[model samples]
Structure formats: structure tokens, C-alpha cells
Target: MSGAPERRTRGRTSPSRLRALDAYLLHCERPLLERQDGPWGEAAFLDVGFGEHPWTTLESARRFRALNPSLRVIGVEADPGRASAAASHEEERTHFRQGGFGWAREAGQPVRLIRAMNILRQYRAEEAGAAHEELGQALLPGGLLVEGSTDGPGGITVAYLLRRGAEGLAREALLFHTDFHQGFAPRLFRDWLPVDWRRRMVPGSALHAFFAAWTAAWAEARAQGADSPADSFHEGARRLSQAWPGVSAEPWLWENGYLRWQPPTEVPRPQGL
Candidate 1:
């Protein structure tokens, strides 16, 4: 019910600074409750790599419970300090754990959704797939994993929705909006639900939306022996996988990350993305 009013700022972390995050979480949680308008006995969520942003996940969980009281939400983080803080201050229907997402064991109960924002940015660019693989290993058969990065302000952000299956990936949404930047990108996403800025990111947030198509782009580039992002990612990732068995992604992910890179050349040297 709160967080609808955005007031995010960046700098040294302060009490007021944290309030913006708390509010932002409430904002994101509103729709989630509507999406789950039923009992939670059959559904749950996993919010991975949430840093100080745990408040948002907690707010989302609270909203979900208000709608479906039985729903469960787990807030996980790699940093023990942040994890402890969030665990101590969590609201109802929330659980907190300290560990890397890769360390997630099998779930006793399946998850409906997993929000992994800004999680992979910390890794080497080429390791995106391995990052996915680490999280993928924990995903329920049909669960959706959303990935993205956003500034301290709530608005300026990009997110990709990923699904599991050997055959392909279903990207629920690859969206970008700048208004969430608070005082920053105020004009970014000043529109409606699905904000559409005239400009697009490298591959746009939707680069990973369709795996088969993305990977084919890579394979095609490799076949042509062209010097494109596709060829670079395809080859680079191949080498990485060969060196570390069972860690490769479906060709699509590498290409997706390749395209997601800013200059394409900016991707890790190995991927050449």
C-alpha cells in the first residue's frame, strides 16, 4: 500500500535513503498481490541476491500474504551482513538466508517465481550462463526467474524474465524504463504499465526473451565466421564450457548476454561479446 511515492537517492547510506528502498518494495509488491489473489498454500517466491533491497522483497511478500495468506517468500543474499539485517527486520511471511544463489539446494516445495535483480553484474561478463545454471538448478520445472539491474532510484532499470526447459526459454518480459531513477532519469519511464522509450538497449532487455532465436543468431554468426557479437559469444562461451564441463548454457544465453553487452566488444575477452 506504500512505496507508490518514489523518493530514492544515492550517496552514503542513511536512514532516509533506506526509506526509499522500503517504499520501492511496497510499490512493486502491489501488483504482485493482485497477481496472486488466492491462498498461498500452493505458491511461494524466492528473492535472490537482494542486498539492502531486501525491504522490497519483504514488502512484496507481505503484499502476497495479504492476498494469499499461505504464500511463502524467501529472501536470500550472498552477503552475511546484509542477510542478517534483513532477517532481523523482516515482516510476516518472509524468510532470510545468507548464501550465494548457486548454493541453493533442492526445494522441498516448488517456487512460482524468483526475482534475481542485479545479481549477475558482479560476475565476469562471460559467466552469465553459469550464473543462470547455478540458479537454474534450483528452479521448479515451470518457474520464472527475472533478472535485471536498476539504480538506487526505483525507475531506471532493465529486467529479463527467464524460464526453464531444455527446448527453449520463455521471456515473460524484457522491460526498460528510466523514470525509476528518482531524481535522476525522471523522464525515463514517465508513462504507463509497459513503458516504451523510443530508444533501446544493446539487445534491449528482451535480448534473452527468446532463447532459440538468440542462440541461432550466435550459431549463424559462428557459421559465417563473421566478427559479430554472436560469433564472439558463441565461441567464447564454448571455450569456457570446454574448460569447465557441464557449465554451458543453451547457445541462446551466451548470445543473449553477448547482445546485452553495451558495446558488444565490452563483454569478457573470452566471450568476445
Candidate 2:
């Protein structure tokens, strides 16, 4: 089937950046995997928009397979050239296919997770929701859909975790990562918002207010001589959580430079509306 246009970029990803994601998957699947009867039957992970050099795909597959030996990893690329290149690196349990989000349904099995890192950047902002809906339909019940991008040598990343709910697919959390020493910049977070939300990063929007608040807290912490970027980040998260009860400070924020928050459901109205 025809697919979206490819917008490839070169980057490096270290396995350490995925530690928080790994813990989350294990937590979500613990019930089934730890059941007395036995682990769930075979499960699959789809790495969408895996570019020509798919080291991230291979690394993710290896790490996830280590977590659950029964899992299969499939790299899906829209560019035929990239897909062919990815296939050259296939292992016993990992495979590659030339397709896009649409291929999620034709995988011949229910997908437990789909990672679409940096995929949405290739499409216009208006196309994000439709793309998400299409991919959502390809998930197994309770499957996860992680969509986002990384920046600054993969030390800073942002991802939105969505899960198939009874009503439909709902965003579960916003995941953030940064370098422990450098912390994160509010503007950098702005760069990571999903296509649809990127334009809403204006003065009155909640997302805008969120980063503004974070930036203020970060500045305050730095002025107070916080030991490191990690320390400043923790303080910023603390400030945000205190100001908005919806935010939470997670323990993983220290070591992994990760923080998660369940965003408010209401879409922020434009200022002066």
C-alpha cells in the first residue's frame, strides 16, 4: 500500500534513554506475564517510521525481547529504500516491512505496542489525529501507542503514551527526558509537542502555561544554586505539581531524567476568547 512521505534525519540513541519506557511496559504487562498459568501468547511490537539506519529498531527489539522472550519486533518504514535497508539487519525475531501506519492492521497478529518516534514530523499538523486514529485501530485491546521525538543527542526526549480504552484510544501520559547535568529548556519542550498541539503553545494555552511555569521554576532553582540540571528539573517538576495538581513528581526523574504527567482533558481555549 502507498504510504506517507519520508522525512529522514540522522541521530543516535542509547539504550539507557529507553529505561523508563521499558519499566512502563513491564509494569503494564506484569499481570499477564507473571500469571501463574503462564505468560500471554505471542505479542508484537511495531516500530513505525524506522528510517534507513534502524539502529533504534534493533536496539529496542533486543531490549524488549529480553523483557519478554515471546515478543516479536517489526520495523515498518514508508520509504522502500529505508525498509529494504532495515530488512538487511533483521534478526531471528525481528523483521522489516515496507508500509506505514496502515500496515499495523495487516501484521497478522495483535500488536502489543507501537512506537512512532519522529513519525509525525513528516506530516502536516492537521493530519496527526487521523494518523493516530488509524494506528490506534491496529492495536490489541489495552495496547500502547508511543509517539514522540528525541533531541540533543537523545538525552532529551518527549513522548505521548496512549492506550486503547473502552471508549477509544486516550492519551495516558506525557513522558519527558533530559540530560541529568544540562536539565531541559522550556523552549526545547515546546519543540517536542505533537503537531496538533505545537501551534497551541501560545500565552493562554495550558500547554503554553505549563512550559512557562516549568521555565520559571527552573530559573528559580538555578538561581538558588541547585547542584545539577537533574536537581533543577526535580524542583521544576515539584513546582509544577504544586501549582497544578494534575502533575506528579516521579522517582525516576532523578536517574533517568524522566517525568510523567497525566494531562488535563480540556483543550485550552485561545487567549481573549
Candidate 3:
């Protein structure tokens, strides 16, 4: 699902993006929203790193407005084109801006919900932790950050519902396939790290994995040392899993996916430590 564009499209947008959004909404998001907020208290949401297409963000806004006109949504796209496209939608409760995860926090608000699709798949493996932490910091304590990638416009999409900070864990995730047009199904979770940032390596791409490592290391700094971010991360991750075991160690390891790290009671010593 990382290389969502790995698939193709009749138009500029990879068909995966379009299809994935629809499946997630029809099968998952709406019901989840109701359960999470009790009939629609999620009037505010953040799109952490939208690229060229904020189509999903705009569509989400439309649905939220329909569900609760008081709902207000913001799209934070690092790319101007995506922001512009989202802006064009200009619906009753949708808005777009040019920035990264810090956009809203910079403006002073911890979002209730965040969507950071397609961002992780592109990062270098090592940077995953720090990136997750940085992005996680912007969420309200109990808020959710859905992270993952789709194959293309309407192909197959898989994403995880990540919570904010190291203390956050994915409560649920979904997988969708357009070939048969099935709705989203909840994916099991694990306490293991959601991704292996340290293992990500690129041969010829301009993107690098060091960021993933840095982010991850920072996230877990406290767990790694008295002055280490890994140590803190370990503490956060453990607390998260304790709060929700489903996110601890996914029983679905044999499946195509599972949670990454197995958190410890105390800040875990880094693997190498």
C-alpha cells in the first residue's frame, strides 16, 4: 500500500487514492466516527500531509458536514497544488492550507482527528519513529491519526488508526480491495512498532530513510537512555499498549501485517542496547 501509485490510473491521480477513500468511508470511517464521538462530535479534523490531491479530504468534509453541519475540517498539504485543489472544493465546512503536521499546532489547536495517508510509505525507514512522534504531538489526547496508503484511485487501500505521540497506538485499521469492491475490514494490531524505520533504505530516490530513523529515535529516546528519546518512546509505547492491548502485539503477524515493536513495562532499552 506504500507505493499506492505503484498501481496506475486513467487520470493523474492513482486510481488507488480515489477507490481507497470511498471504500474506507462507506465501510469504515462513518461508523467509526459515530462510535468515537457519539453521533458526530468530530466537526474538526486535520489532514497531515496531503500531496497533489486532497480529494479524500474534501470528500470527508462533505460527509462530515452532511452528518453535522457544525463539523469543520482542515487540510494541511505540503504541496501547493493539493491545497489549491482542496481550496477549490470550498464547501460548507472544508478548508485547506499549505503546511505540514505543525500547521494547526502552529495556529494553536490539537486536532480531534488526523489523516496522514501515503506519508509513511514514502519516508526512509529510520525516520518513521520521529515522524510519527512529531505528527502525533499535534493530536488531542484521545484523538486518532489514521495512517496508511492505498494502491491507487480505487484499488486496495490499507491504513492504521494511530493515536498521538508515543503514548498512541492504532486501535484499528482497515484493508480494502476494489477488484472485488469489498468494504473495509478491521485489521488486527500489535504493540510492536507500526513500521521499521531503521530498515528502510532507498537506492536511487531523492528521499532518504535517515529521517525515519531520527524521528523514531526521537520518539523512543527516553526509553533508550536517561537522556534518550528512545527511552521516552519506550515508555510511551508501553503505556499505550497497556491502555489498549489490541495495539500491543497483533495476533495477525502471519497476516500481511502486524504492529511493529513489542513495548515493555518500563521504557524499553533499544534493541542494540
Best by lDDT: 2
TM-scores for the candidates: 0.52, 0.83, 0.54
TM-score of 2: 0.83
lDDT of each: 0.47, 0.68, 0.48
lDDT of 2 by residue, 1-273 (tens): 323344555523444545545555565455433322222355568888766578777777666666566567888887787788767788787889887787868766567788887778657666676677777777766777888877635666777788887878887777776664444555666677776676666766777777777788778877887657667777767776777645756554534566677767623323432
Q: After superposing candidate 3 on the true structure, give the runs of residues whose Cα lies further than 4 Å from its correct spot.
A: 1-43, 165-273
* True-structure RMSD, every candidate: 14.5, 3.8, 13.3
Give a tens-digit lDDT track for model 1, residues 45-161.
787766664666765565556555766788877667777877776656678877665444444545666777655544444455445556655555556666666555443455554
Name model 2 segments beyond 4 Å from true.
Answer: 1-40, 180-183, 264-273
Give lDDT tens digits, candidate 3, residues 184-251.
11211111123441232233321132224423543454445525322333443344344542334333
What lDDT does candidate 3 reach at residue 243? Answer: 51
Once fitted onto the true fold, the runs of candidate 1 whose alpha carbons sit more than 4 angstroms away are: 1-43, 90-92, 106-109, 166-173, 180-273
Model 3: lDDT equals 0.48
Residue pairs whose backbone atoms clash in candidate 2: none
